[model samples]
Target chain A: MTTNPNTSTLDYAAVKPNDTRAYSVRNILSHVFALVVAGFFLYAAYGKIGPVNARQFAVQIGNYKILDAAYSNIPAIILPFIEVYAALALLFPKTRKAGAILMAGMLLFFICAVFYSAIHLGLSIDCGCTGKGGSKAGWGVIARNTGLLIATGLSVWLYQCGPCAPKTSVDS
Target chain B: MKHIFGVIVILIVSVITGVAAKAMWYDTWSPTKAAPPQKMAWVKQQTSDAIAKTGADRNQPGTSGDASEKVTDNDAEVSDSSGATDASLTADAAVSNDEPEFSGGFPVAKLDMVVDHLINGTAHFVDAREEYEFDDGHLKGAHLLPSSAIYENIENLMAVGVLPGPGKPIIVYCGGGSCEASHNVAKVMAEFDYQNIYIYVNGWEEVMAEPDRFAGQTE
Candidate 1:
């Protein structure tokens, strides 16, 4: 990628694509956020599938009253695979875009699930957000997800548009 | 791409399904209904002993400085058998009593003393370990309640209906001094009003070392 020095107005213009500038910074933030989400999901899924079992997870979801009678065993058996996939997907550059979008969507769904459970269903259960550290469903979860959503959205979008073109010339 | 979508779909469906199943399985989160309180008999014996001691003291020459009333209030505070207070009050008080009970500061007990209390029916010693670790032969009577479930199922202790209230003494020990779960649990128990809480720093490693004294085995 190349950029003309005299005509560009973007602040990131000074940053070169391969010059250890905005590109690296952006990549670092994006990967970090992706890994964070992956870590959270992996921990949650592990709790459900490994030791704590999925009953607790189902109980939180049951607060929504959507599926009614088949909540526990389903999450217990399925979440580990999805979490592992999400974690792995973020590592591959090709898959990173889709992974970010998927992560954003998952977080959005969780926020909605918690909201619905709190207001519409009127049941209060821990969000199991922090794995065993006791992160419950509340404004904190929403706020945290909203921040991640913005960061992740920006990362995925910027990466798609391509980093600012190198300014020192391709030969340099 | 197709596989990823399939995996997401399955994940969502399963999470939703699991939620529904848990709601139907248990009507309430309390678990005391499954195991009756083990303290009632002990309470009864203590009450009778208290009454006998008080009676003997009252009959003595210069010991009539409000014996019965003080004894009555103390006994009633614990197990008022006469229903002067609601059951919830007693239950709440009992729950509070289970808080770590320490007097005159954090008195460090000897390892043998800790094990003796655990084995001689002094405290409900619990081992906060993973299921596999617990199944591979934990301290004989140690209850296997993992740290992960401690917060989620603490209300289950309320369900047990026999907690020693907010000031009870409880000793929490994990795998070893390096394990954080036991100390973490001890801290939470303190928050819940467990007054005399102690973290067995050496935990199982220390306990297992002297099996004859702690694990009921003559090594």
Candidate 2:
């Protein structure tokens, strides 16, 4: 194989295209994780955005007591769309990093909310995660959010470290 | 930066599409228009049939009308006609000329008033808690009419013969104070023209807190 005279041996090996099986695996894993997370968000958004369910979703948000009744409607209105957009972004290779980051941030926010509801607020209301009649907000909900966060983090890492990373002039 | 902008554009488009779809398809898209009111006469007819059924059951041979009273030794304070009158008067006075001063646009029932209805067997109790919560514990003779179920299949409730006719007073409750399930259920009942709907604001939690007051009747 012809190599660039100016390139160091280690640098050439690191960017070599032949040993791409690991990259393929990492890419596949990232896509799988992204799809799973995207499906979850889409399903959740569907459950929450329905006409009848949306009102209930708003009420559930109000029950958290984190926002006033007037402001509770805002999240009820916008969050579902945001979820849909994030899920869509995750489906495409070019936008996967942005999607992963957004999903991770959302999962972290949800974890904090669930944790507060379980520990600090001492509330026993529905978590409203799926937009329908959800189970009670408690440790289980926090754990679920934590799992999603970890998955999103993995997706971000794989996107950054695997074949999806941007090519530099040295690779060419 | 380009990806960020792309995400923002996607978000905006998603929201617009969602809003448009909701507006076009959902009858409940607008807050004010959700849950259109039912005819008062239809509600009256339903209530009358229920009352007639109750009357017929009371007259049946060997069936004791006082069975409920015997089951609970706690004599409700508002059982007497005079006490009922006073309670009704208090509730009426609380109402203004405009919107009713009740939580769910229905009359508010004090615990004693609810107990009186329970003893007399004149009211139907609807537990608005989830099925699992209802299964855990609930008032004796209470029907599980969860808010979510009602939203999904209101006809199922009517078909099941659980919802008493308009003539029978209905008492709805959830977990307890600040719990919106009961209120939401009550609103739906009111829209159906159930005129004598009442909300027990301090619901299962309060009843469980003072089991003696309920005469240990909770199941």
lDDT of each: 0.51, 0.66
Worst 10 residues of 2 chain A by lDDT: A163-172
Per-residue lDDT of B48-150 in model 2, one digit per residue for the tens? 6755554454344563334423312222112221112122323323332222246634566667777877877767788888778889999888888776545
Query: On a 0 to 1 TM-score scale, where does candidate 1 land against the true structure?
Result: 0.42
**Model 2 C-alpha lDDT per residue in residues A91-131, reported as the tens digit of each score:** 78888877776787788888888778656967556688887
How many angstroms is residue B191 displaced in model 1 relative to the true structure, after the best TM-score fit? Answer: 29
Residue B106 C-alpha lDDT in model 2: 57
lDDT of 2 at A155: 77
Q: Lowest lDDT 10-mer window, candidate 1 chain A?
A: A8-17
Tens-place lDDT digits, model 1, residues B67-95:
43343344423322211222222222343
TM-score of each: 0.42, 0.74
After TM-score superposition, what is the CA distance of residue B187 in candidate 2 from its true location, in Å?
3.2
Docking class of 2: acceptable
- Candidate 1 residue runs with Cα over 4 Å from true position: A1-20, A130-133, A166-172, B1-219
Q: How many clashing pairs per prediction, in order?
A: 33, 3
